[model samples]
Target: MVKLFNEPIILKCDHCGKDLFADSQMSIIVFVEDRKNKVIKDVYVCCKLECDRNLQEIKVKEGLIDGWKDLSDLTNPILFLNQIMATFNRMKNGWIFEPNAFEKLKEIYLACAQYVMREPTESEIKRASDILGLPF
Candidate 1:
């Protein structure tokens, strides 16, 4: 799959009639879920305030939580950015992750971020393994 942060798409909010997205800015994050209700995959975006509010309302109605992690974990934006970039590299290098691998990686980043706040421990390693789908 060719992942390019390209042009934007406009979508309306279920609550209000408004342009939810704009071109060349940010697109709406369209994420997919699996049969078991696990997040299968996700895509990021830039959207309008109404759309954000609408999504929150719907998720609230369904009692769903946005599991997206903080992307500001890594101090250096370049290295932090490389985390997602490396996933694609690994895919091309034959380390293609499972369908929901990116989501797991996001969790891994969160774990690492927490580790950065305290003494590193074995649990962090376990989390890393789990994110990579490796047996502990």
Candidate 2:
């Protein structure tokens, strides 16, 4: 497993709804794809080795892994969100004006708002709301 990020991120297992600390060794992130090679879903699991194996087998049987990706290391959501915001700001300031700019910025802003609102930490939610100028 490649270490993509050093900090831990909160995630919930799609199958069991169990809280998963992405920095934990037992955590697994799996991406499922259809036969045509389009990604369909992403599954996060924090479980024992046996459970991980079982999930892989089940997904294989369902033909959801024609070309799949598995990663143990994940980026912290807050950091990722901050990066997104920074990139959006840079683009807003540097890029030529486009008709879709408003829509694109709105999309990113709404994504940040939703993520912070759903975050488990109150501090994170409040800070993100304040930074994004969103009333939560």
Candidate 3:
């Protein structure tokens, strides 16, 4: 049994929803690697061992990831949102951040704060409510 150094949380199987343990015997380590053989992120994971084929072939559909997704398929809005979050975290953590990036994010935050501080006109409030998917 390989050292499952990471704590395992029992997950419900997607197919049958059976509570499966995340152990070396019952699970495989999912790893992600870059083109240079460096791991970036390990995404999808299933809590079922593949070696028990001969014991009892539980038709555990090959839902095993062992791979990654194409990031290029994401939309610009989603990318922008992710960038905003990452930038925010970087600044909060006090990392060596770019001055220009900090200024831009500060501007965005200031503009938003200013907008929220001022009392909006009825029409503006209505537009805001509609934009927030609220019933107003």
Candidate 4:
């Protein structure tokens, strides 16, 4: 009798909340860089249309595109707020991040410490709460 082999899960899909196996054809990796600190962050998602679109939207909204890459420096207020919301969403969805992910998250929060340390305005609170199902 032959025994079936099961692939190990490497990570979770940031969009669909699904387990990503070692060789999932649908897996895609996106990098979010904190150029000011020379740090690179990774975002994992499946290659489904909705998932891909959501990632693209986040990039666009965060202004991480080719010419606007400086927007991801973590100093921009909008970018900082968005990153915090994204982290929150990931935690809310029970994503088990790797160690480096934690380090990057720590770097991000530290870089934006001033913003976090201060009182958030009513507008900021409203905008942060308005996560329209985008997976960061």
Best lDDT goes to which candidate?
A: 4
Between candidates 2 and 3, name the one with more favorable lDDT. Answer: 2
- Indicate whether candidate 1 or candidate 4 has the larger lDDT: 4
Ranking by TM-score: 2, 4, 1, 3
**Tens digit of lDDT per residue, candidate 4, span 30-113?**
555443433334433444457767766665344333121221234456766776787678667655555675764564355344
| Model 3: lDDT to the true structure | 0.36
The candidates, ranked best first by lDDT, are: 4, 2, 1, 3
Expressed as tens digits, the lDDT of each residue in 1-136 for candidate 1 is 1111122223332345443332313223333333234333332222445555656554433433443322233323565566557556755755433445465455444433332344435786578667877654
Per-residue lDDT tens digits for candidate 2, residues 1-136, read 2211233334555456566443345655443444344333433343546656767776645656623222232244565466556546745655332334344334433433433444436686578678877765
Clashing pairs in 4: none
Colliding pairs, model 3: none
lDDT for predicted candidate 1 compared with the true structure: 0.41
Q: Tens digit of lDDT per residue, candidate 3, span 5-89?
A: 1332333333344443323234322223232333222222234443323212332223321432222211134543564576467
Off by over 4 Å in 2: 1-10, 15-18, 66-72, 76-133
Q: Give TM per candidate.
A: 0.27, 0.39, 0.23, 0.33
Of 2 and 4, the candidate ranking higher by lDDT: 4
lDDT of 3 at 130: 82
What TM-score does prediction 3 earn?
A: 0.23
Candidate 1 regions exceeding 4 Å error are 1-37, 41-44, 59-61, 68-136
Worst 10 residues of 2 by lDDT: 66-75
lDDT of each: 0.41, 0.46, 0.36, 0.48
